[model samples]
Target chain A: MLNEFFENAPCGYFSFFDDGKIFVFNETFCKLLGYDKEALKDRNVESIFTLSTRIFYQTHFFPLVKMQGHAEEIFLSLLTNKGQHLPVLLNAKREEHGGKLFTSCAFITVPNRKKFEDELVAAKNVAEKALQENSELLKAKADLQQHTERLDAQIQLVNKQNSELKQLNHVVTHSLKEPLRKILIYSERINDKAQPNILKLARATKQMRVVVTGLQQYVWLDNTPSHFTHIDLNDLAEKAAAQLRQELNADLLNLHMVKLPSLEADAEQIQLLLYHILSNAIKFKKDEKAEVTITATALKQNIFRSVEHKYKYEDFIKLEITDKGIGFDPAFKEYIFDLFRKLHDTEGHGLGLALSKKVATNHFGLIEADSRINEYTRITVLLPLFQTTR
Target chain B: MQKNILVRNNVKVFGNGTQPMLFAHGFGCDQNMWRYITPAFEEDYRIVLFDYVGAGKSDRTSYNAERYSSLHGYAQDVLDVCEALELQDTIFVGHSVSSMVGLLAAVEKPEYFSNLIMVGPSPCYINDADYIGGFERKDIEELLETMERNYIGWANFLAPNIMGNADRPELGQELTESFCSTDPVIASQFAKATFFSDNRKDLFKLKVPSLILQCSEDIIAPVEVGNYLQENLSNSTFKLMKAKGHCPHMSEPEETIMYIKEYLG
Candidate 1:
């Protein structure tokens, strides 16, 4: 029974007689490494196993089996037919039978048993990376949605405004028809008794026509974008002066000019922009004379200011309009360039300074306002010179 | 520059060739409100349709509360239209709130208009001594609250519309933009100014020939009040149309147009 038990163990087992020689090996041990039991039988241990493992077996496995009588569950590496290493655990013991010393070993592969643990770690890493990517993608999608919504809203608002503007134009234009017809009819209907009022009505209708033209011009000028064209500076100044001649009593302006230059720019916008600035100067003119001077200089050199986003400019034209107006405090620096920003309750849209800045920016230049409270205001405008390259 | 008796933005004789009729629409509508009624009278009368400032297609920039607060402002608007058009010796028609506006305009310049026709008239909104204006300040306040709540509701309602693609509209976004465009505060204030206004006292002193077409079973203008007006008005006719609801022009257009044609004839 004892011999049968020793020979028929579940795993490969073996015993040695204190010598580096195989005393016994099972069918299972040989099969585990893709070798036949008979082929490995009685083979020198060093030849069948690798040298390092063979040395370890001789030194550790032999001593432990010989001295301790048993060495159970030890890890070891074994070589296969293809020269690949195999992880394994060995069990062995020192034994004495019939007055003979012997060493025995038993083993099974271990790397296969570690598969569950490694799979757990890999799954954890994958989940963490997927979670990070999902959140980032979600955030990016949300930001894109918000941007699209805002743009769509702006577009819709613009369309609605355009529609209303068209309707307004229709109403205003259609309105002129009846009044114009009445002027023609009533002028013919007047006799001596009703002649005075009738003639007055006719005159009013003609005046109405003038008012309509003014309305159309105001709307047109307000809507047009700042497009560049050949502009006459002196003409624009004089035109503005003429436009406000009736209201000049409010400002009591004495417009004077130094030698000025005319060039290509957004003609209507520049006209309007200058008009706004000059008007603001007059509207807030100090106790001094409401006199304005216009001058120009060739700004060919580069300007190095301590500001970010330096302009890639090759040349420029500098124009300065100085007015002895009730200038604002210097503390309001750059505020004049803000749209609808008014420091005083003066007449006209608060677009004067803002419009000037817009024109300056559109010209690939900048505008600076230098002034002292209750003193004088100087508006400097820089214009980019056009260039061509081969 | 020949300023007459300052008849509230009035232009006396605006148009020629047998002075045509002029129409003034109520809030939220332009002269296009005249569309349902004008064609009935267009064969015989040259009709004029114009929007008021801050409403419909009128100049929104010109909207100032102090200038456009009362029927007086609306009356001024009528006068301005007449002056702008050079209209004269024509019948004048007004709807809803503009009904009182037309009456006041006629009073301002009697020579400019042959008659005044007021549709779906309401003289006052709140009840006072021997008078029923049909609405109170609290009612208008509640209306404001309702509008505020409704605006929020509408925003949520339209969320889907804006969120979904342009082709596949989400119902949510559609409602939100529609409600968002109409400022709740403005609509409430406008409603209070509209529903709570009182212009009944001006009726007893009417000088021009006038026609009042009141809708029967109207929540805005009750039938009993219409009868009471017929008894009290000095030179006016109160004819109740066979229609229900505040706006017969929307629910029963043909009946409303027939009544208008009858009065016009």
Candidate 2:
């Protein structure tokens, strides 16, 4: 009866040698692993485990049992002959017999405990993932808040600049225009043909009117809000060419137009921009016929003076108006774009490219002029395909 | 911020004698585990008791996980305590895992200690081909799992229930209740550090006189481990007490003191 009790014990028991060869096991041990008692006698315990569990058994389980002499409540999984998992809790003891070390192991099946442990591990991972996502969300919210604050600061700066420009316009109109009007009236009243000072005075009055009008136009462009609309550049170029023909009375002004994409922009401002640029091209022509080629091409990179601006990586339409005109020196290219900056004794106010640049900045775009002395002038205007609203 | 405060380890110094005896508790509980043992040595030795960081009331804020990831951290804490009290030629009695902690301390700074007494000590808890450390990897993992599940209980309730040591209800009850008192997170990390650490290679590095007190039937550290220490240690003697559990200092304090006194002589 005692031998039967040992054979049919409630817990499975087994013993292994130092080389991991199974020396003996109870009937219960063989039943737990679904192996016949004779078949399990020579088997290594690690063979019944999966690859990862086998590694854990070698690196952790065996080493721990060696150091601590016995290990209790160790959870592990074993494989059955039919390819099924059997989760078990192991308690092992080491003994020295005849100068050789041997280990005895007992196994108790606990399937539900394994399932519950897996659930807890999954829950922990889920909580960690949620924490990571929460931190990312907070970071995004902070970035958006910073962007809004920066935009508010920029708007306030622009508003302050606009009010200052308006104040200057008011001061210029009241102070400068009144004295100039008096000078013109006084010069007309002294209409003495015998003195050459009257002619000089008349010339000075005309120049004053031109300067004041240019200043007023500049101030108005700086302050006035533009109404944005969808505009086809092909139609815009034709309209500008027609208007220039009507103004200069030159029907033979050659304007070679290529296909241009439609865009959302301030149509009036853009038309004014085109008119100033086209008129300059026509007026500055040193050849027999005024030949100007206007072509629009999509750019991959938004390039400026000599540096590259990376506001919008792509989606920019560059309109290059090349003219075989009497171009200035390459050194004077940037200087020609400054307001009231006269490089030559020209007929009009030196404000065409400056006004074009102002219009481009208002549209969140850029304008650059490249000219070689006595060769050609290319005035390139880079505008986005879609304008961002304030 | 003061190293003195941290190094002091919230020391409870009692008794008065020519020789100083510092008691370092093991993992699971704190310095209170020596309550049953300290009184026996109170007459002839100056007894010093303190808790490791993250255990009992030893300033939990000072607990650094990275610093305390190995046995070296606890060893450094032992040296820190020695420095704080200016202890010299002290007899260091360490229980359970603190035995290795004290051993490491004596090896690093031998001047601070004269005799090292390791109660139920295992240098490494994992077994090798030639050594018997008593536990496997899965066993330690289960012990950690058991700690995690039962750390929040008013009484650990699982270890005693599983061990079936109902005869000594108060000892397990005291240990179980103490388990709930620590920060659960720190307790779990400490468990991993204690059981997973392999100090077997450092056995030959001892420079101080030592005593290995092995319990008769300890589930944690058995007799072979103590024998291994005795054989490997340069100046050490092994003694086996007729105690049943891993903590002979608690269950059999008089016997423990007898061997300690005998070893000191």
Candidate 3:
């Protein structure tokens, strides 16, 4: 009865010596591999395993069984004689029979269970991939949030600087105006013995008044609201050239104009911008002739003031103004646009480029300058053709 | 700091004599792997054993994926243990991948070690045009897949056994609680670090005298790799044992001990 039970059991059982020689195996084990008991006399246990399973057996199974004296629920695949893989759930234990040490193993063929387990593993891999992608998206969202916060901080800083500039404008208008008036009146009333010094004081006070007015205008650009209207650049450039020629008292101002696109912008600010650029060309002329050229082209591209503020405009106008003037060092090209920044001791209060930059920024545009030490200077202004409602 | 290193690596030190003998375990198992062989040296040498941060009962929270991603990270662990114990002129015994780990440590700090004994060491595990480390990239991938499936199966099997045998501690212990049990994620990472790593150039950097114990028919580290190490290493001895498989110290401890003793003598 015991022999019949051993031969007809549901699981296959095998015992191999420490050298991996098969010493005994149940009839069920032999039948599972399609070999009779006599045919498996010299066979080693690892011969029936698939290559991966063989590696697992040696590296994990054998060592584990040897150390712990038993290993359970180990998954491995065996190669049958018919050249097909048989997935099996294996359990092994180290046993000492008499004086010899051997390992006895029992395994049940688990084809259907292996399929289920494979599906589970595949599902796990899919879930892990999805989790990884989700985390990446979360990280991207966090980066965008940080960028927005930085932009907010920058906006606050600009607002603070604007307020401080307004306070300086107030001081220049109220505090310095009364004192300059008193000095001019007192100098005119002085005796002839101090006439030279009094004249110098009067001239200096007058120049100071002009600087105070320029400072007010620069501060007023940010305070006043902009009025948008359809303005033709060709008309504005002609008027600006005429104004500059009259202001400089030089008909030698040679203004070369090109047909430009009509765009909706602040007409007053655009005229001021044109006037300043033309006046600068004539003022800083190399000799008697002030040669200035203005051209405009339409573009279709996005404009970025900063990385956070990207203006996707349907149409844009790129205006280039080139001048044959005494250009300063190229290194000070960017610095020349700062309020009251002067590279040379020229006439006027060094506020032309600063006012021009302010007008460009107000129209959601950008202005960049390029120059050599003695060559011509080119100022490029990029503006949206049609302003979007803010 | 020294106490923290000891706790982090689960370092154990106990022996009879003054000379220090540090044993580094291989990829799959922990320091318990040296249980069978450390006994023979206990009479005359101080034995040191430790688990890598991710394996065994070492502090799992101390595991940094970036630090332990390379063999040098593990070598740093060896050096840290050496410095923690203030060991000098130590005899280092390393098994499988730890063989390369010890070699790297010795190369960096040669004064910490005197002699090296490597059991089934392979500098590289993938085959090149002229060298054969006995595996292709696909084989290692398949091994990883097999490991994943087995870990899932083992976890599933152990969960119920633990739940049902709450009253019987011995019964719970009789289950798949073996020395090779490791966290699946860490085991997979360690496997990638071990198999995908190529340490062929590092062989020339060793200055300490070494012994390479090459086992017969080791699929992981074949005979060609042993021969390659013997040729490249300047002060090294090579031995091909009759034992079969990747781990000889476990399968044939007596032969392993005999060869190690003969080399040390």
Best by TM-score: 3
TM-score of 1: 0.35
Answer with 1 or 3, whichever has the higher TM-score.
Answer: 3
Model 2, residue A123: C-alpha shift (Å): 1.1
- Where is model 1 more than 4 Å wrong at Cα? A1-390, B1-18, B151-186
TM-score of chain A of 1: 0.41
Off by over 4 Å in 2: A1-118, A125-390, B1-8, B152-180
lDDT of 3 by residue, A114-135 (tens): 8998999899889977996798
How do all the candidates rank in terms of lDDT, highest first? 3, 2, 1
Residues A147-192, candidate 2: write the lDDT tens digits: 7898799899999998898898997778889988898888888859
Provide the DockQ value for model 3.
0.15
lDDT of 2 at A306: 32
Candidate 2 chain A minimal-lDDT segment of 10 residues: A303-312
- DockQ ranking from best candidate downward: 3, 2, 1
Residue A28 in model 3: lDDT:
80
In what order do the candidates fall by TM-score, top score first?
Answer: 3, 2, 1
Better of 1 and 3 by DockQ: 3
